[model samples]
Target: SLRQDHEVVGVRAGLEEETLGGGGSSQFYDLNVYLNELLCIARLLDQPFQQHFRLLSSSLSSPALVLPGPPKSLARCRAKAQVDYRGMRYPSSAHLLDVVRTTWVVQDEESLLEALELLLASQIPLSSPPSSPLRSSSSPTPSSPSGHTVVRVKNGFRRRGGYRDVKINVVFSSPSGFRVIG
Candidate 1:
């Protein structure tokens, strides 16, 4: 069995290695779960993950597109936008949180907001503290937050169509320098 299998498990694991933190999808690492904890820490809190984004969109409703567990990197060649320091074609933030994760956090749910504020308090600007109260679902913010910038977004869930929930966008700047949220 050993000689027959050319690709050993150990070698494969090395390619998809990730810190104790969530895989670098930046959903949780990117909020991939980073929001649940590390709100009290002082210094920049960040986790390293390696994953290739496959058509990063506002909502990944298509059950067809399954998330690559263990975090995998794409080996395709693509142009990196350098004008305003745009890293890769794929965005690293504001994918919106899946309801399943929050167990459908709805009205009278301020815990999520409070938790987010605490997580991003250090990097928050005096004017805005990343506390985006749940707004009228009728009107969702058109665009979401950018990776480099952590401006609070007015939209979190879709009010119409397949989307129906809305919440504040969370931003966490890691020690190595990267923003991830839910």
Candidate 2:
């Protein structure tokens, strides 16, 4: 009976290995696929056998590691602009500063949100935003007579590991200020 049990365990391991090792990029990509396969294998064994195999499988699998990419250049540009326009200047300089300030603030806030999302999703710490471009629709026009402009910003986070991380769809109805709908 002991010899029979060992043979069964060996056979089960072989089958699991074959299923897991089939041609693919990585097992982490489709967790559901492996999980379904695991469930089928579990059903073939008794309670005690199932527990043993579960431990073996758990030991064999590792959590996926996602490496963060280099810090974004936009943040640096924003900082430099802020420093360069720190002092009061001619009327035209002030106007230019106002434009730059508004644009920079919006971009900075967006970057903050993206960073937060990445930290939550990947369990990786990123000191700066990813290099991916921010998506913004054409300047909003008055959809209603209320003098409000409806703008849409669609942004997504893509990891350096070739996995598309998150898609953020935000809509803002303004003139009274920005309100995010997502």
Candidate 3:
């Protein structure tokens, strides 16, 4: 089993709510939403990459995230889409993974703030009209005018007690079709 062997098939993203009762807030994203957003970003990064993935399994009830190196401990995580990122099977998939790894990191409060700032800087609300200069129908962000699907910022100023977590969705989409993994 993945948990027993501690096999890291994919990236481990920790999403925690700092506030004692902020997990349920609408401002923050639930696990489902977070994964879906990620899936969409993957699609946006490279259309070919999106078609290469398939829904393997979702350990939502017990999503295991094994930390590498000393003091290896599990973190709160979710994996909805699994891709064939091994070697030449899907060349661009590795790049997508690298982009995800580069953007998603949560070691401490400072790191979390930095990531949040990145998201805030990189993303604009999807609700923005097409005419909005900051966003167009096709472009994801100005920094990524070429091809870079990054975190999308949503409204809501969380309370001080809220958890320090990034919301993600669990979704999978292949050439066959799109399915909500969870």
The global Cα lDDT (0 to 1) of model 3 is: 0.28
lDDT scores in order: 0.25, 0.25, 0.28
- Candidate 3: RMSD to truth: 19.2
TM-score head-to-head 2 vs 3, winner: 3
- State the local distance difference test value for candidate 1: 0.25
On a 0 to 1 TM-score scale, where does candidate 3 land against the true structure? Answer: 0.23
Q: Per-residue lDDT of 1-182 in model 3, one digit per residue for the tens? A: 11100112222222333432444432233335433443444334333332221111121222223221111111212321223322222111222332222113345656545544543443322221112111234532232112112333332335456544454322222222211111
Which candidate tops TM-score?
Answer: 1
Using all chains and alpha carbons, the TM-scores for the candidates as numbered come to 0.24, 0.14, 0.23
- Tens digits of per-residue lDDT, candidate 1, 1-182, equal 11100121000111121443345453223222222222211112222211112222212332123232221111110111122213422222112221111112323336445434433442432222222112233422312222222334455444656845443433432223223342
After superposing candidate 3 on the true structure, give the runs of residues whose Cα lies further than 4 Å from its correct spot.
1-103, 124-144, 147-164, 168-182
For candidate 2, lDDT tens digit of each residue in 1-182?
Answer: 21101221111112233444546422322223322322332222223322322332233223222222222233342343346533322111111111111011113445546543432333212122111111224433322111111122334444454533333221212222111111
Cα displacement (Å) at residue 133, model 3: 23
What are the candidates' C-alpha RMSDs?
19.7, 28.9, 19.2
Q: Which candidate gets the maximum lDDT versus the true structure?
A: 3
Clashes of each: 14, 0, 17
